[model samples]
Target: MKVVFFGRTSNGKSSVINAMLCDKVLPSGIGHTTNCFLRVEGTDGNESFLLTEGSEERKSIKTVNQLAHALHQDELLDAGSLVCVMWPKAKCALLRDDLVLVDSPGIDVTTELDSWIDKFCLDADVFVLVANSESTLMQTEKFFFHKVNERLSSPNIFILNNRWDASASEPEYMEEVRRQHMDRCSSFLVDELGVVDRAQASDRIFFVSAKEVLQARIQKAQGMPEAGGALAEGFQARMFEFQNFERRFEECISQSAVKTKFEQHTVRAKQISEALRLIMDSVHVATQEQRIHCMETREDRQDRMEFIDKQLDLLSMDCKAKIKKITEEVERQVSNAMAEEIRRLYVLVYKNELHRHIEEGLGRNMSERCSAGITNALQNTQTEMNEGLKPLLPAPVREQVDKLVPRQCFSLSYDLACDKLCSDFQEDIGFHFSMGWTMLVNRFLGPKNTRRALMGYNDQVPRPLALTPVSTSMPPFPQGSMTQEELMVSMVTGLASLTSRTSMGIIVVGGVIWKAVGWRLIALSVGMYGLMYVYERLTWTTKAKERAFKRQFVEYASEKLQLIVSYTGSNCSHQVQQELAGSFAGLCQQVDVTRQNLEEEISDMNNKIELLDTLQSKAKLLRNKAGWLDSELNMFTQQYLHQGR
Candidate 1:
């Protein structure tokens, strides 16, 4: 058993310990007396002291006074070190019971002394807080002991109200004062420090005059005033019977510290148990995380593939619907674009003023002009339509392909598919535009010299008509009509010769007719107005026919283009579905492989956790057994204390 004496400077902490040993083995004085921890234990008929420093050999000392001198002199020792005394004191009751007494330096003297107590003195089985009983527990006394209370268990601590001899002025008054001090200190422990039992509180508080105990022991050793003789008046009357306090202290020490060895054993075992618990908690958390990851991986492998497959089919249908709607929109855009271009051309032709020659020239080349204008207007519109259809293309196939294959391989597949779709769209547009244009000319222009403008055609005169495979193609044109180039040339010649022809014909016809009319000016003017009106009617008729032709072309082209675009869209949608399925399936297989690897790792961690659980169970059983042994030790010590009493 180990016992530590704790208190303020000059509080008689060393005096109490000296009295317990019945030997003045430690120094005590007014100012900063003992500054180092001194451990005093029993030895076999030999007295010695040793000073220990940091990692240096313990130096043996010849006398007890050397221990105090070395501390005061700061020689033969380092700061934060202590001395141990193995004295051959066979008469000491504590040494007989295997108890070692520790005299700590007065607390709160310096941070160094406090550090020494906190670091080295915490493991004592019993702590005796020795305060001078001249006054009740002071604020400093309560504070110092409160700190000690924090480090040690409450059951292992006791309060010693030392130097009770002063209150002997009136014995009855002194007794009442001692009771009040005991009660006040007991309440401080219960109310301030949460000590549970008041009875135990009162039992642990001892009021003893440590000064008187020291004096009595010294005088006895010197054999002054023979054994069993009455004492002389002054100093001898001051000898309070401190032996009762000593016996009570021995009793408390026996029951509280000596018998509770198993408690110390249990404390160590609990520390090890707590360390294992923390490690186990970490392992368990790790295992739980891995298990959750493994479960999610398995779920992804089983459920995600089926869900993606279903979504792919739904996506295909949605894309097909989107493609149909987009193509219809493209048809409308193309028709609107063609109409706008025709309106612009009409403005350009009419803005210069219409004439018979210019009207005829425009009519002759109207088919070629309409074809070129429509193609240019529709070029940008067609490109916009192609881009709009891109989102309708399925993403999963391209996305999976990119992930699983090299970039070059994915690029090859993507580019080839796009090129094929574009080529088909261009071919269909050309076929339909050519067929629509051919039908329009043969029906409205009386295509006597008509030929396909967009497709390759026989450019020679009197060429035979060629058959076309398109269902919308019209019958062959009649022969013997002016070609578009010939008509344009003839119309230009008519315009250039118009001024000379009009002057000559008017003179010849007007002279003969006016002679018949007796040279009447009014009659000749009326006939000229009539000829001019007929020429104006013919010019208006030509414009109406050109307007009719443009309307017919627009309607025909819009219908035929829609059919061709729809066919191209269906083929592209089917191809996209096939590519998507193969690539998506390959990706699912790779994910499954990763999940299997995780499952293997999770299994290994579970096995290790199982082994740790077994060890934890064994540790708990050993701790319980230690607690039971401690209970038996308490019972035995209590019976022995009662027998001694």
Candidate 2:
């Protein structure tokens, strides 16, 4: 695995490489500069070469003037391919692993006629394109994106905002510059994706003054060589600043994912809990005999109805309260945690630092172009609704609203927005609770065993009643077949038809009791009152039958109600799970895609940077040679003129 950078000419690729290496190997400059591919191989001891024509050649130091023609022709590269060369100083660094660094001639310098930057980019696992902060996301950069993207899927791309400090006064101030650059960088990303919000062409992007890191690294190395006092503190500060940026970014992403998952789970758990509670409340009031056993007249029935109604009201209220509590708990636990994390990140991580990270890590040309194009396209999308309408009725006579803005109202007003928002929330908040509460009501409301307690089912057997089971030979009810109503009716009928022999004994007793007139009169009065009491009790008994019938109807209705609520809630849960899954999956995919894009942007930026370095190195060598030649020419001309005189 290695990092290769490529981009438009003079995008500070040289400065990026030099900074990365903590050395001044490549001079950052403009124009036809790079002479050959300078391969920075990490250990692994893999031997390869840039053979002259066909034979193996030895690596040697050559002046820029000597390599000028091949640099222009790009001939040093054997048919323009990758050639590995080990970095002598970092030999120890390479022996452990393989992370080769390959630098190509600047895009502008690589054979003016034979262009193949896409090939270089395609070969790299991670392409890092470096662009200057001053002229980033230029038109030329856009072309580079088109070329490289044409070859392969850019999975791991990075963008390094090289020479980032050029835009600001101090290293501190560069953060703002990074933000501005990233905003433009984001545009390019939109362009590439062809979307308003999508992961651009890169995996990651970052804005760092590679120059600063390089300078800091160099200074630290110098400090190591020579004992320093204040330099140590400065070194510590730089390292801290760098690490802080990385930490904050990682923390933000981690916390965001946790918060999202937490909320999702909380909502689902509360729904299940509510369903269980609903089932419990409906079973508490029924008695062992499934009877109310009320010993009262018609007046009692009305009083009982009133009490039962209040009980229903209380149950309903309790269900509502329970739902509210669950919602509050979810909000308190999950939302609060998210808020606290956000606050912590804000205080510890600088906003500017985040922007810089984005710029450097995701500032690749392909990423920028993709993001920008997409954003522009979305923003440009415009169409008016085709439906035509006219008012149908006169406006309501208002006391206040009409005076403030008469004839300037629409249905989708601010008030409607508020209402709409509230309506949308009700579907979410009241969702499972409403179903569970209904199930509870259904389970209890009907005249089942529980309902008898409310409506008053009397378990009374009249004093004179005698049950006679006349089992017909043809057919007889099974043991538990007779309902309480059936048995009570049979007993009352038997008492009414009691034989004359049973009456003869009562008559004899009546005659004897009558002879003692005074005492008999007292007994007769008691008997007369008891007869009236029977009459009253019989009427109450008739009322109880009616109450029992009503309870039967209520029970049947409750059973149906129970079925409906249970079915509805169960169905709702299944559907909700499916919908939630779809929604969550889509969101997760979006996040992953966007993050990948940012990372790719970072890689591209890094690649482009290395290309710049190679160019600058070749150009600097030529520049020095030119100065030497010019000095020698001046000396020769002066001597010749003096001797002729």
Candidate 3:
């Protein structure tokens, strides 16, 4: 509890506090000795110290003189600055009970009354206005309390008319003067400020000589009579009034301090405890709801994951079957296509004028066609497979699988040259007397019948006929004795031989026959047989060679395309399956991670709920305790008011 002294300068404001302390701990003089605000409070032990404003250094005050000197040194130029004087609680009864006395610089000295009040008087439990008893309350002193009344709610004020002992010089007017001061001070407090009623205001005002009280108290403490020399006539009565004022001041300050300071704090603590309890309860509920939500979400994810696993198994099986079927279909289609292309190879060779270098030009042409055909087939297959797999996958996985489709399943180092299909064809277009009879016979009979007979001869001539070897073993026969059949056999066998020496011998024999037969017979026979032999050989050889090439190329090309179909189809199928599987696997991993996170969140929420539960209980207990204390404080305030009345 703090009691602040406020009045005009030289009105003994510091002397009032010193008189209460019963020591000259504060610097008090006729001038404005209290330059700054000084707050005197009690310390725990005998250790008395002076704490200047904005300085931590403690100046020891072992005696009253030392304390006075310390206070004098701390006389700050600014009236708002404060110096705290700590005296031993054992020495002063008021200090021992937590009573702090603040002595301000004269109110009339500074125009900054608001700064002075805010700095020293706002929290003061009791304001003691030290008015000079020799004079009426000054406007500055009255105006100061008016401001205090505005800020504080019904502040407890005591008007101590100090230097009242001076009234003894005019003893005849003392009673009238006392009556005038009492009426005016009481009217100011009751009518003007309206802080209290006339009765309470009467009790608040006092006529006291602070100097006489201090002097008397000091002399008494030193084992001297309380009355000193040159005393006023009513000095004893004045001392009694001063003690009466101290008694009322103590009661008012203690009660006012409780109501003003502790009551507000008690109310605030009650509100805080209740607010904390409500907040803890709200947090606990929120955490429980969040934990439940996480659990439900985790359960839903688990169910989704199970469904995905089943779907993946089914998709895997279905994919394998589809791939197998597609591979077979590709092989069949590609093989048939290639076979048809090879069958038409002769058209490419013949129509494109590639007969001269048919092997190179036909190989290059077929290679380009094969590459384009196979590429188209594989690309189409890949597209179809991707489309088929897309519908089977989940939405998230499908998009990834679509993007992951292999661009090209088959990459070849070189084009399909169809090497075996472009083999060298033996072109034989030579004349023979063996075909001379067949030509003459074909002219009379139909061409089909002639072709049948020639085919029979063609088949036998290349075989090792026993009769042709017998000719070489037989005795030398004259050309004149030989029959036409025997001669024909000899000539045909000799012509069929590939050796140059045999062909040269056959040519010499034909020349000899020409010479014997004469020019007319040889020339007419040669002209007829030569034209027929040449025409028959050309047609037969060309047709036969074309048929043989087409047959061989078809077989070779079909085999090559079949191999390509198998490899490319299988590879594409595998890629599609891998893409699907990989996408599904990635999605599964994400789901698992989400589940893990949800589990952790649920666990965390559980812990938070538990913690909030504990805090809620503690806050509830604190709220109950504060409520009890607040009720008791209100009860005590009511009792005090009744007693004062």
Candidate 4:
């Protein structure tokens, strides 16, 4: 961890550092002196880098040319040389342990160096934006404050009120002056940066004269000068822990001096971590609406499949024309855009030729392979989208089918030749990353909607439905802890740094002796100072170099993780969609068969009942016929008897 210090041009950062170091390791007393950033560490010797040509390399100081805007990004041609600023290494201290405190180049009222210094400040773990007690929040201070606050959710922001000394004989004047200054500072911070609500602004802003404080501590320990008990009292309590200070007295005072230096550096690390956690928590809340929204899934849409594919085909063709336009523009601009590289015709031609080969020949050779990289990237993206939708699914289906995504997938590319070619159709320009095309073929193609979604952050969530592809051929940044083996490698690297600094210190000392001005004692002191300077410089440089390399390591790791997450999100989404479709089809089939069976059974039962009724009716008719015949015979007998009488 590193503790980086920044302030306005003439504030007292160098003075404060020297106070901690207990010696004027860094020469300070002029206008905007330390131009380029220099990393300092505790060491046993002195070394310095001189300004002129015929310059001899000394221990303790490194003076490189001011870093241009060119090297702001990770990739740079002179990155190796810039990484070499380190000094004054220490171990077994609370504040500055393995700490690289960057004394950034200060920006006055000028904007010339503002952007450059801004970059340096951004790189620090904690930002200590120094404000003077006199007219504390100046225009430049306000600007830097806003810039840092906007860009960084910082952990520790320290405002040091430098050069405050009150002689008791003039108590009234000093008290009034101090009170006014403190009140003004409080209001500025509260109104501008919002600090007053927490506590007293004066308490937060420590009033310390660096020169006086350093002198007080050294004299108090050595018994050379009277301790300004009043001044020393406040400085001791707030800036450093009393226990650590006392512990120093137990050890040899000289070693305690070094320990205090390192302790200050370490404190910033813990402060940064604390402040970051607070801000993250403030924004980290998962909203009820978000929870509801996040779980929501798009309806299981099927009809759009054919429609979408056809639309995409047309879009892809339209994309090709746009891509062709861009490629032509790119080709035209290539002469100017790549002019520097054009000097090396072979390398330039090689890259151009390779890109062309990939597009014209290899691209068509195996379409699957050509698009495989992107297809893989899309699947991973789909997984992320699925995750965001996970909570929104129905409870029953939520657990089982929540992660599903449509599997009909394709890859396409988009290209823009130049600005004018793209300006008219700017909306389409962001659509695809086209490799190249012939005069006739503008090449553009990719996965439709998912490409656009991955452009922002939070698009890479690890849910099954998350949709974002790892675009760009470059590798991603790494995250998480380093392996023990890797850590061991770093320790080895650190040991190497320690050795180099020690050796550098020795050479610087020897050089000072060789160029002795007068007495042997003076020469030796100069030699020793040179040695210490070199050692510190070496230590700081090695640390910076290590950090630069670590960045590369991190990116590589992240790329690998991105691929994994995207794949999981895609596969999960597809599986859920497929299962849902299958279930619906099965239910429809079941309902149709049941309906057919019921109709057949009703027809059979009706026919049987009608047949039984007909038989019963026939029986009744037969009985009635028998009765009629009997009645007719009886009537005929009665009529014959009446005539005989």
Candidate 5:
């Protein structure tokens, strides 16, 4: 805490601080002695040093006279500059208790009163106005505190009527002068400033001779007797009054420092703790609510997961059964359609155009008709199966499942190469005795028998071959077929086999015919064979050979279609099942991710709640401690006041 002294020039402001320290720590003279602000504070060790403003250099001051000389020489510094004097705490009781005394330049000598107050007086606990007893309070002195009052709230002020010892020369007017000084000072503080009441203002005002007090204290410190002098009249009374003033000043400074500095800190600390506790309580409530919300969401997700799991189980079983039933229905429809298409195969093969190969034309026509029939049957089955499975998917996943299975369950590219099937029919109407033994053997064995020998055939009819009439179970849908990978493999394998067969046939026929006949014989054989082919062509339309060719082609087509019936139906069913399962799994994965996020949020909220709990406890303890300190300070003030009384 700091106590700052302010007054006009030659009013003993420095002498007052010196008397308070019981030493001439500051320079005092007949005129302005303190040119700059001097701050005297206590230090721990016995070392006393002077530090000039804006300089770190320490000047040791051991003797009182040396201290005075040092301050006098410091007159070169501006009045606004500050110099700090560090004296041992053991030299003064007030300084030992953390009191600092600031001796400022006389207010009358400086126009920067506002600057001075802002620089030094803002933090000062008590302000001492050392006025001369020979005069009324100067306007300069009052204006300084007016500026201070403007900055601080109800600043603590004490008015000292210094040089009161001169009143001894006029003992006749002593009481009158004292009463007048007291009334005017009290009126200025209570009426003009409104800082205190009349009674408190009277207590804050004092009339004492700082020079007398300083001389007496110096004599006492040196253990010397009171100096005998003619101006010693009323010396004892003046000393007593000075001692009384010291006691009041000490009590006032102590209580003022506590109220201004320590009490303010205590009150602020209490407010901060209360505010923190309230904030922590609010956070704790919010966190608890959030945790509850997270838990509820997690539970809802768990229930959803359970429902989805049940739905998946039911969907799996229902889909399997539906697919099996659909497959059987598709197989029956395709078989009937195929049988009809095979019966009409003769229409394509028996054409007399001969512009292109008969085998190729028949193969192309048969593939188109049979593929269309099978595609229609499979498409109808797909539409029915998709309609059946639509209700099985949960509402949340229905749109995604539709996108996955878009048009149909699978693709059907039924490329029936009729040449491979119908090539068994041989043109045997012409005489073959001149041809060769090979021709004779081929005719006796017959085209059907020869076909069986060249290409393997399973004549055993497929089971469950009975054709059921098409049912209007569901509306027809657009056809889809095998995946690209499966289709590519099938096409590639078929082309490779056909290429190998063509190459081998070319090589065998060219090599054997060339070896069998010379060039002239080959030409003669070709001429005779052409004449016979024309004759055979006319007989190719005979009823017997037509029936035989048609019957053989039908048998081959029917057998191949039977195999396709089972494969196409079962493959489409499996594809539908896979599409449904994949969509369902994706939906389940999304639900699991949401549930995991909720769990993490709940855990974070729990940790935050715990942290808030700890903070609240700490704030509570801090608030309690501040309250205890405030109470203790109040108790100490009351006891100190009682003792003074």
Candidate 6:
């Protein structure tokens, strides 16, 4: 039977072992701590201690202090190290060949200590959890025991609440405190750790002062008075509980050998056999259900894919038709909307008596009014166009597109198309109005002063009369009359003056008209055949201007409608395609996962079913051996108890 002591730092785990041995064979103190695990057992003939560090040769030591020093030495102690102390049966009766005591270092000190404990302490027949009673079970203590309870094979756990002497001064308060600690530790072990039940755990709890016991034993060994000192008094007070614990621990260890190990192996083997059978059955059922589900999902996915494909096909076929229809609808709505907007803009422009501003210098007022009108028209058209297009799109597609295409999305699209149309119309109106306004201004203001003279402003100033010869001056004529030569020169000079004046007027007045409409007219003339040219030039009137306006409006509307159709159709189609692609990909991945999982589960179930027969045979063998051992141990227990009675 192997008993292991586990606790945190400075909790007197070494002291507890010393009390049990009734000898100072193990080091015990805060400064003289057990850094490594110390495994002590009784030797019948020779007493010896050996320290083993991994693959290194065992180093023999003669005394307990030397063993402690060697364990504490950094160079000597390697990973997974331990000190084995062998002593004569005279020193300690409990340290027999069959029973060994392992004193472990504080659990909170190092991480490697846990691995060390797990390596050597798994098959322990009994566990002594030496917890500090001055406080409740700490985090380290709970954690250490929680871990120990998992790996330990034995169920006989003894919880020693060490340092119980601290509470001796106040008996009533100490009892209350002890009760609280018991309740808390039990809760931790039972509820938190799930290692033991409340009733069984409460019985295993032993309150004793390990330090007092150690001191009492040491003084008694030194031939001093046993009951005189404070240590002896405390030890006497707590000795009964400690002795009771010892008796139970011994009884548990004796039972642990044949009944515990054999019965556990027997039960565990049977459980494995039963558990494997259940698992195989469950896996068979689950795999079959999963395979059926996969088939159903595959059919469902096919149906869904076909439906989606059909929808996409129909959408593609009707794509152009839908675009045309939607374009017409949008154009009609926008036209109606713009008509109202244009009328509103006209009303606003004409408001406050526009004819009044015309009289207030047409150049200045017309410039300001035209600029203000264009701005107002632009703003109002944008608002009206957006409102018109807003209802054209269904909410779902619109919302999706809104995220994809930012920057006022629908409004920006509507505005771009509407603005293009507005710009075309504005250009026609501006061109015609500028020509008409310039003509009207020049006619009213008399061709402007800049064009009235050829060279300078002093052109009308009279020059000094030129002197002539006596022969030419003989005849004094009337101021208005002239001879044959003078008459001819006067007529020729008047004709040249009239021609120059007419040419200057034509150049200034026809500037814009000649550049625009007049050039087109010239082109038509040059291109037309003989009689057709003459007829077109004669028939080309302002009626053609009306035709031009009608043509410009149609072209502008058509261009804008096509642009709106192209952009919106592409965006809507892309959004639909993306949504379909994502959904299709996800469904494909899910189907793959489901099918793969079902296959793997079926394969695993088939493999485990083959191992069931072997497990059954093993379980039968374990049960037979365990039964024979149990009977033998029962006879021994009866004999021992009867003799004691």
What lDDT does each candidate get? 0.56, 0.43, 0.68, 0.43, 0.68, 0.59
Tens digits of lDDT, candidate 5, 1-645: 788998887789988888888887777866447778889999998989989988999999997678767877865688899989898988876689888899988788868888887899888898888999998887777787888888998888889999888888899999999999999899889888888888788678888888877888888888875453333577777777778877888887777756767567656755675565566556556655665675566566556556656665675566556556655554454445455655565565554432244435534544564445555554565555445445444555555654655554344333444455445544444333335533443465554444443343344245553265555896654345657644544454454456566788667777798898767888888899888767766666568566655555555655655555455445544544454445445544544454465457556656665665565566556556655655665576566433444
RMSD of each: 20.0, 43.1, 12.9, 63.9, 16.7, 27.7
Query: How well does model 1 score by local distance difference test?
Result: 0.56
- Number of clashes in model 5? 6
Could you tell me the lDDT of residue 527 within candidate 1?
78
lDDT per residue as tens, model 2, 1-645? 445666656666655666555655444445535444555554333432233424466443233233333335654454255444444344233223454455665555444322455445544554556776676566666566555666544334455666544544466755677677777766665667232234632224565565566566666667753223333223444444434433443343333223333333444444444443333222212211122222222224344344434543453354334333432333343233323332332222223233233223222321232334322322222100000000110123122222322221111100112122222221111121222323343354421433333323355454543388675665754445567754544453343334333887667677777776667586878798677656655565545554544444333333333333333333323333333333333333433443354345445544544554454445445445544544554464445323433
Q: How high is the lDDT of residue 253 in model 2? A: 31
Write candidate 3's Cα lDDT for 210-271 as tens digits. 89999998898888889976678899899999999989987787678666775666567656
Q: What's the TM-score of every candidate structure?
A: 0.40, 0.31, 0.60, 0.31, 0.63, 0.41
lDDT of 1 by residue, 514-568 (tens): 7777665756777776676566555555466566544444344333333443343
Off by over 4 Å in 2: 23-32, 43-55, 61-83, 89-96, 109-118, 170-176, 193-203, 224-645
Off by over 4 Å in 4: 30-32, 42-85, 90-96, 166-170, 200-203, 220-645
Worst 10 residues of 6 by lDDT: 407-416
Model 5 CA deviation exceeding 4 Å by range: 30-32, 51-76, 143-155, 170-172, 190-202, 226-231, 270-322, 339-410, 413-645
Report the C-alpha displacement of residue 146, candidate 2, in angstroms: 2.2
Cα deviation at 123, candidate 6, in Å, is: 1.1
Clashes of each: 0, 84, 0, 82, 6, 0
lDDT of 2 at 240: 46
